[model samples]
Target: MVVGDASLDIDTLVIGAGPGGYVAAIRAAQLGQSVLVVDKEYVGGVCLNVGCIPSKALISAAHQYETVKHASSIGIDAGEVKVDFGKVQAFKESVVKKLTGGVSSLLKANKVQFFQGEVMFINENEARVFNEQEAPRYKFKNCIIATGSRPIELKAFPFGGRILSSTGALALQEVPKSLVVIGGGYIGIELGQMFSKFGTQVTVIEGTNSILPGFDTDMSSLVAKKLKAQGVNVVTGAQAKSAEQTDKDVTVTYTVGDKEEKVTADYLLVTVGRRPNTDGELGLDLINIKMTDRGLIEIDDQCRTSVPHIYAIGDIVPGPALAHKASYEGKVAAEAIAGLPSKIDYKVIPLVCFSDPECASVGYTESEAKEKGYNVKVGKFPFSANGRALSLQSTDGFVKIVSDADTGLVLGAQVAGAEASNLIAELGLAIEMGATVEDIALTIHAHPTLGEITMEAAEVALGHPIHTFVK
Candidate 1:
């Protein structure tokens, strides 16, 4: 009991109002806990406000802008297409506003008290929450820490006049005439591609041999091909050294195999990676919460921290820093608090990249399965062979399913084509349900649809493909 502290007692205190924090707060409330959720900024956090939602909105706009310009290939000649960047920003803001407003409404409807302020841990079960005016101490039985992450700022090129972070890039008022992107990871590639589509001369500097290095070479190659077609300069195996900025433009200096090169552009976008927001005035060390050497919070299956009463989720904890994954962990943490036997099952967590042709993966890849000692059977089908893909003029990728060669059990799947983000779901479900190649092949998929490609791929694995001639 929080003795003598009338205003501080609560059933649960959720810090950080991002997807993980807000979802956990709502679920905890649903489970009959009086919850108080606090964020230093807004309710919807980075994903809805500035990261995923806004970025996708801009991506969609850029895609449409790029599509109309080249629609003559598809016999639809939409002439003289121009982008009104003001309107594009307005559209992005409107989307962000709607979602943030909805989250606020849901919090109210669920009776989860939402506070806009910074939360600092004063003790294990207690904290001080305040903004500009007042500082009040809060005592709770259980707390969920979801203090997300921030874009890593490079020491050489700090975020300022010409140097920009992902947040800065997303908030740009006008598209730059030229852009230099450091890091060809998902963030860098996605933003770089978007700008390139917007008629910006984009040059990507990646230390790895390929962009989106986390993905396989085959999948990354397709995006690199698209980028080349779009006139993007991708400098792989390069190390960014430093930056020089002027009011007119900024210049980036990098090295490629000891060869020094410099590129000047209207703006410099540094999307190297994101670091956990574990350090700050938040004072997590005061409570002695266990953390990894990399500054990530250590959590168990139930998302509970070393301090049993407190839990952490999202980018702060170890795992892929995805909003969906964070939201999943949030629910599990809430349910565990409610005395429900909910634990995390990461077997089928799907990964999707909103690139030019869109790539997605679930469970494992071919090499991944093989490395795990499974005799893998790869069922590959190209989107070029899919009727829907051809009709949609987006047949630039393929879907591959990896299965156990011995038992034909679906181990994992990868999609690299149109609507791959949506298509990977079925394969993920197959892995989760322990479905086999025969199961997918036997399931009748509708003709002239992209889904048929999945079924056909399974047939190829089973050595009875109908679309392709098997020698």
Candidate 2:
């Protein structure tokens, strides 16, 4: 061990302390490696602090508030409901604090040393971690980089005052009377719909022809319909040019078709996308590590970078910037470092959106299967016919399963309805186990449950459905 101004040696050093870094540190420690994790901010990183956990907590609160107001349709006859924004913010913070604190306890339990600082590579094997006052050198046998991504800021709309990024939107004290969302992707729509549920008039400006561009049109349409029913104005093919912020509100100038228009709102939120945190300060070039033109680190199947003995995961590497994906890669990278036979196999990475009627998909979609030269068979069952969905009065979407027509092999599945996030996990496991349509159909799902919706959809794919009539 080194005292002040000396280089300390460690078996493994994990950088960034996000889902990828923290999980890798724990797993590496479990494999008998002395692990040390360093991060500049909170231990749980952005996903728990500002991105996923807090946003979902806010969404869950908003959904309950919206649900209570509409319970009369189900004969519940709930009285007038109102939102206390301050309490809501406090609740969201509590959830984040609990999860992040739990993570810290877990790291301690695993005996992995943690430090609060920023890291710069001194070489391929040595690095200096800079805290508030001083920098300490560390030499490690191996290291993993998981710095994650940040919300992309546009030149026209720098985030400040009334101009907000996703982080700023999450931290707002009061719900705006009107909000202009500049992107229609998952983050944009999720936050936009959340604000709408809280009685904020939301106008979504999407550059593409449709919102939720990554999702199939059918799934996105269901969420769009819910947004419209909730009094949201969604404008497609609109380009946000600039924003003018004032003491009270913001005016956003956008163009759709041949005409230019301006809209005024209490705040403007920009959620176009996230960019990798691979530039400036980190000093990847100092180690001669290969990186993409967009500043993403290149990694092999085992999450190993061009430099052996170094691994990169999460948003810094290529693929979807999903927390679960990063965690999975973290495990793989950790096991691979322990000389376990593990590699990255993303054949069934599930993608989910926690919108009004959540959307989730795994494996290959119908179009994707066909594009890959598989004869596609699709079976869709609507939530309108589901007993549980009807009982809850939340039947606005459907479950669709895509399979191989000849073999009845389940290729992919999509669910857009209440509790879709939970429903999609079974399908993801089905794909991972290579289960066929008959396999899912044969499994007895509890009656009058959301899981039955998936079973019925699989039966429909197999050409025999019990819930609904199909030819």
Reference-based lDDT, residue 10, model 2: 92
Question: Which residue ranges in model 1 land beyond 4 Å of their true spot?
Answer: 1-7
Where does model 2 exceed 4 Å of error? 1-5
In terms of lDDT, the poorest run of 10 residues in model 2 is: 1-10
User: Cα deviation in Å at residue 197, candidate 2?
Assistant: 0.5
Write one digit per residue (lDDT tens) for candidate 1, span 272-360. 88899899988999999899899999999999999998999999998899999999999999999999999998989888889998989
Question: Mind giving the per-residue lDDT tens digits that candidate 2 earns over 100-126?
Answer: 999999999999999898999989999
**Model 2, residue 100: C-alpha shift (Å):** 0.4
Q: How many residue pairs clash in each candidate at the backbone level?
A: 0, 0
Model 1 reaches what TM-score against the true structure? 0.98
